[model samples]
Target: MAATYKAPLRDIRFVLHDVLDVSRISRLPGYEDATPDIFDAVLEEAAKMCENELFPLNRPGDEEGCTFENGVVRTPRGFKEAYATFIEGGWTALATHPEYGGQGLPKTLNFVVEEMICSANLAFGMYPGLSAGAYNAIAAHASDELKARYLPKLSDGTWSGTMCLTEPHCGTDLGLIRTKAVPADDGSFRITGTKIFISAGEHDLTENIIHLVLAKLPDAPEGTRGISLFLVPKFIPDANGAPAERNGVACGAIEHKMGIKASATCVLNFDDAVGWMVGKPHRGLQAMFTMMNVARLAVGMQGLGIGEAAYQGAVAYALDRTSGRALTGTKYPDRSADPIVVHPDVRRNLMTMRALNEGARALSYWIGTEIDVSHHHPDPAVRQEADDLVQLMTPIIKAFLTDLGFDNANRGVQIYGGHGYIREHGMEQYVRDARITQLYEGTNGIQAMDLVGRKLSAGMGRLLRRFFHPADAYIAAKKSDPALKELIGPFAKAFQRLQQATAGLAQKAMANPDEAGAAASPYLRMFALVALAFMWAKMAEVATVKIAAGEDVDFHQRKLKTARFFMEQVLPEHLAAFAVAMAGAKTVMAMADDEF
Candidate 1:
């Protein structure tokens, strides 16, 4: 079974150049030197890595998974080699700070490359992906001495990293975590607790594992405010930055379950391990969030990646597989039956997947660009605006992208029909692989709540104002553009509905504390549908102009048509969601507690 994935470079370039406008990105401080030649070279290398090293291992890794024995975790065969290849390519640190041995590429470029890696092998990508987050957190908050010691190895993939926040008893509720970090004489702490659902927690891909564990200190405040971050390693690095003696961190077990089988999801026991503080004492949760926000967006990329992969596979199958004749005519008369691609419903599925995937890519890259601008922009106001945009869009990226990713993956299975259900065809693998994306990374539901409850009204609707105002103006301006007018009109209507929902949630919150929580998830979905439609409309605008230029005709036409499909079929879901939001808290709270 050869792993199947088309790099979608044309589509990627379309998003980067025509849709999101990456040329403006080059003007940012560190990004000024990111030449087109360099961009092409980097993407070319990334395509080769995904098409060769990573994609080949995806299936085998899924089948073999990881093995745990005697406190050791062994990754699937060929994963170690594939991961080594990944490190050698310098992908692990592609977007890290240049001062710390990183390539310092624009984060949006990294977003494109990341989708390729994940589409090729999401499980393997997690190893380095999580490490990048750890690297970012350390770069952001750790002291200069600590950064000097760890950043180089992590950036180069001499060491890998893990976020050890979730425990068996507590996942979303950090307040309930029981992990303890006792301060030691040398200013280091002894961390002792069990952490579960830790991806890349224990793996053979790297020599040492840098565990960013969250724990409570003695005399620390109770709940989340008291939680602090510690840099606990599997084997402590010596002064020379080499793995020295073994640390007390050991794998209790590895989880066995659905999807991303190749990823090492470990239950780690840190028994009185020597740990160094990464950020301020009693601010561990806060510090870990820096890592979490990065991870959340990265996980959202997983959705985009898987969706793209599934769409690619489904399109191939649809073009090749023969089935019932087209209702209109016999498109393929020479064959036993017309190809599935001739069928309207099949086209609907593929277009839905394609439209959603492209919309997500554009939006994700846009958000990634904002992340770069947030960090590297010269003006503080520019940085702040970009940062605020990233914050507002984070939950949408996590929730909506994953939701559509899962749906698209399942739709791919449907496109394959009976064969898709079997393991050999590989469609089921995609379906399974995509499932966990919705569950982890704060869960799409939690992401929704964060969007409506925290992000929308957090600053008394100020953040929502920043996002919607520009969108409103764009919709108002694009009304006369015939190609985008229809798409933008519905999206604009949805946007107004979102504004109404936003105000409704605020009013409900004023009346009842629980009202916000009940309306949060649906409101998030309503907003995301509109946001993605906005992206599709933007793409349609770009596509319409590019098609007029007479370059890449088929690609631009597909973009225009898919954007049309999204407006026709997908954007309408928000109307129902808005209706649901209008229904309010009583439906959710009315359920009896003992009903379960």
Candidate 2:
């Protein structure tokens, strides 16, 4: 059976307009024209492209994968055509600067569209997704000349880009990289190195590929400090800024991956490639972070996207497949057996997937709004606070969302039983594709460590107040309301546990750092749960008021029910997480080095 996709535009609009009130983004200088009508049209058209063009290619893309012949990558059938359609629709420049042939829309809108793309086609989305990150990096850190050279093409989708960071010897440890860069007579550098696991590294979709590579220059310091960022294109441009001659970069080969097979993960070898520095020499890591931070959020969306796709498939299957009758009675008296949707177990799985997907979506969009405020807010204090919140939540979003996305994919497979195991159903492909989101863009473990080790203590825990104060304020405001008591009670309890755990981990980590390391993963999970609970509470508050006004009663009621299910069924896991975090690191460290 072919995989199906609907953009969930209703929920998307609800989260954007009803929950987050994204119109406020228009107050920022560049977003004044981001009216509701424009947002609706953009989303409606994006939905058409994603559902009509991309979703159908997902199964075939995974089945056929990418083909590499003599250093050339051919994306699965329909990929190039779909990509052309995507670019032609002006989707690529949706959130970019107007000066660079872009629409100058808010980044929040870009993220909303991105989620639809990822849901429709995870692998194919990488081509433009990588380009967006690369554009961000150059726009932020590169010189005016470099920006003028690269930004226009990247924004317009005439060309694509890649971030070259990892080598064969070093994955996360950038200090261990052995790539070398040497200065030439005309001020450009000659870059030579082999970068592995480069997504969108080499492809036939574009005329040129701009690679943001990390290499070490002569006389540079040791370790990560020695690394420098270089803008090395596949074909060095002529004076007119068009591909003039072939540079020394070439695709060595592509990886044989477990999933996202349609995305070409290449091993790129730069043999003294002509390149120019992107930022101050030896400050490449900081410069690259301009890309990494956005990339992490994009990866989080990938998780949410795959989970949503899986949930939809599972729900469709559950509604159609028949098995034993319902526990109480026959749901379909006219049929031989009731559909699986009538069963409690099936409902449980579907609801879990649905709740997580929706809650995560709300939380992500809220974060996206924060990102816009961080970048564009008029008040310095407001921007700083929003930045702090983004810093604190990025890891939680990346790790917890991806982890649950994988779990949701599995639940989707479980709901399908044996048919899910077969390739034709496409549930298993979701599982495979979601698996990578947790591993790459800083593994979930690294994200947890960053959360517990750096972000929690940053600014002497002041950054945490970005999340805590709002949550506290919401609980205080809603605690006394009769209709909101159930939601507030659970959320308040989880919030309290989160506070205690935060303080406890701070003390324990101070005494022994391993306690932080040991507790990191569970603590991040707990943090994410509390964050989702907060979003649910906020969403329920809006839904309740709307219900009272007799506006879209069914939608508002379902919102309340989903919030109730999340609070009742899922939020209690914070208790276990809190307990595990408080356990310290002794048991984990006590095991012998080779005991396994």
Candidate 3:
């Protein structure tokens, strides 16, 4: 057996089938046919592909990595063949529209499957993950002719896709991007610029690369308003969707980085490359945002997937590797030493990892279901509510989940102690891989600013209105439940604290501009913990009710214990953040810039 990944099928099923209630999702318009059986089948297939095809390459891929010579980038060995298997398996279009040769599975299911792939091999997973985002942008905003030409091939995985937004001078600040788009005699435009840190920009996995580029039109509005998006391919496809002449797009060089070695992060050069407009000229940022949101959420999943794998590897090692003897008595006297799992501290670390991983799973999938409703719900108001909820939580998902992911990876390494630092042990790799999550996809700092500055004040907190109202009602309802009664006090206090924190930011930022920036990161983290605790409480409540009915007492008991661990260990960090946020800007930015 080649160290297979189990898919966390039980937990995923509990989330999809029980906790989220997929039936309600099926009632939505496009997802009406997303039955339980269909979801299971999708997960099963995804599990096999990730475990068999991708996992085998993870270690070797890290060692071999992507090779570049004279502007040609070659993916790790077996990647092309594995990618072919992935394409043939229809793993690329799980959530795309059926009209575009997709299966149209719910986004929630895709989220589950993605977690597995990233866990098995994040390096390889980036290829399709980026492609999915490109496909979404083109499908949603491209012209009819553009859609007819590209969507089928993308949906079918005949060609891979890339999003080229970051430039050397500008990453988080897109307003400063200098990529220029010049209109030509034909309907197409000539794109000329240098884009850096483009994941999956140029690789041999597919016949051609479809780059969704961000550039500015001449005489257009300044800053972000002037930005326009274009679809530039390595080999410009003919009218019949076949690769024609080679376009002017070239890889200046591929970046050599800390993690995700199998993924080719290239600095792309578009020298008068022919490209077609994706959406309206001035509204290119809008189209790019659609892709960015999808990418952000998916990147959050990368954090989540790596954390899950790290935790599992840690737990397995803890159980099997015996060291110290039991303090009370030898539970395993027959052995030379007691299992590390016997120690309370070991248990605490394991519980922390398990609890955080499970809570994140619930939270991520909950957000995924929200995405489903936002896109599929028949009622516009309901859809808007879902959309607002997704927007509010997306930053949190990207920030908080990734932050904890880094923590868990560190803790996983701590669990192995000395062995963890060694490359072959693989624990350290998870930590290295997880470090990038905080920096990219609009750095965690940027995400927090969006959450506190842009999202909160936008509608006078109307976006959070949908989230807070139901949470308040749910906490009130849970007060009467017996198994969940113990959690009520902490949960209620946390919710109240969240409410106060929201109000405090509104008040402080009104006076000091720096207050929000100072508290932005901590505030987003606190918000994420509170929101995740909220989701865990819901899952705990469901587990309690089910356990009382004598339905899988073991699983429910584990769920309750994990919820307890979260409430005990993870929930209190928010209090420290709240204290910091309450300290105001003087505490953070008081020192002069030259003080250093």
Candidate 4:
């Protein structure tokens, strides 16, 4: 039987109410109406829709995928109907501002919704997910005129969106792009380019598809500096904001991908497409980053979502599938064979996934709350601090979560044994789907570089201060607290290794950048491990109090035990990562280019 998903509502509530006090979000400006009751109701409905409307489609959607012929793309069966229900329920506008038809909630809640969708149907989530990114970029940077025309529909989910960045010849190097944009007399531009790997680029889901395109203007300066952003729609809207004439942009072909088959990955041909400048000319990358950053964080949530789904599936398999008895004796004599859950090895895998998921969830969702605080806080210093943490953690969240997400999904297959290898159980599908998260949103390696090369050094190490100061302070304050005595020592040790790694990488990169590049991956992992350790220790503190108070004893006790496992078994892995990172770039860059 295929594994089914039941949303981790209890754990989610624990994070919201117990570990992190999200009611503070309501206290922020513009989110005064946001309350726990409302958030719970929203999440409850989202869970139902995901479980009922989306989960059933995951297996069949992977089977059917998407079909394209004659420039037309059709999604798997029931997708359009499901999307319609999504918007009708106001799921798309949950976190947007109220000004442009949004519900004016908070980004934190939207993040929870994002996870549910990804777990329920990742491929299906791509459509609305892209729209949300485009919405944020446009909302933050686009002109008021553009916002009036596009924001309402996007907020209402009447129109879908895509980011047209990567080209057939270029994926990471925007400087190598050949897309051209010519100024038109009517304050618009004629864009000609072919963008590849454009997710949700063309589909039968919405009335119009908005493409936030990146291209170079004629007579532009060299490299990415000369690039500009343009708003190009599949069908240009008329005066009444209705789909009028079809634009020149069309899907040339769709990639037959390894997974997320239900989502359209297209080769978008913008042949003199009518588009308008999004931000200042020659500043497209800056504006587009508004969307890219959101997408990157969303990708991290994609990892967490997939991990949670796979974890649940593995747990079900471990408890239900019977094999050999325990080494000592048979625990369940009623069964013909003992359940695999009796094995220590199986317990290890289960514990590993559980620890990673719970830790990542606590950390990621806290970051989500900080995102809201960053944007809504009244004090500039407070806002800057929140933003710094968000910026610093963004890469870690993207690379680390996706990395673990794939690992946990694969472990699902491992636990299921032979049944997991084939399509009957649907465990393999999670693996295939999760494989892309590591590659997309600026690949995990790219994320590492950005962390070390860009964010780590930003503002003379101000961003690092955001995370390190808080973590260091926590370690010092909790070292004597008996509640976290068992967890804090391991976390403090890991944190110190992270500090050593950071100083070493920063020093080496100053002499030869390649040294930093070589170790960025491990450094990022070490940083993530320590950060998650910090989260686990904090969760332990909260759980201890709750358990002492005898509130939700089972839940709080479970959290306390998971926190221990993370510190003892998972967090100590950072030592190896620190060693790998401090090894420098010698062996990594040793081989000659033509050694073969």
lDDT of 1 at 411: 97
Give per-residue CA lDDT, model 3, range 1-596, as digits (tens): 02224568899899888888877878888776888888888888888888788988888898888999988999989999999999998988788788889999888888889899988999998998888999999988998888888887888888889999899988888989999999999989999999999999989999988999999999779889999999998998777679999999999898889988899999999999999999998889999999999888998998889888888888888888798888898889889998888988888888888888888889899999999999988899989999999999899999888887788889888888888888887888888888888888899999999999899986888898878999899987778877687777687888898899889999989988799999898888888888888878988888988998999999989999888888988799889988887788885787889996
Q: Ten consecutive residues with minimal summed lDDT in candidate 4? A: 91-100
lDDT, each prediction = 0.87, 0.93, 0.87, 0.93
RMSD of each: 1.4, 0.8, 1.4, 0.8
| lDDT for position 362 in model 3 | 90
Lowest summed lDDT across 10 adjacent residues in model 3 is found at: 1-10
Q: TM-score for all predictions?
A: 0.98, 0.99, 0.98, 0.99
Summarize candidate 4's per-residue lDDT along 475-563 as a digit string, tens digits: 99989998778899999888888888899888999999999999999999999999999999889999999888989899889998898
Score candidate 2 by TM-score against the native: 0.99
Which portions of model 1 miss their true places by more than 4 Å?
A: 1-3
Displacement of the residue 89 alpha carbon in candidate 3, Å: 0.6
Model 2 / residue 403 / CA error / Å: 1.2
What overall lDDT, based on C-alpha atoms, would model 3 receive against the true structure? 0.87
Off by over 4 Å in 2: none
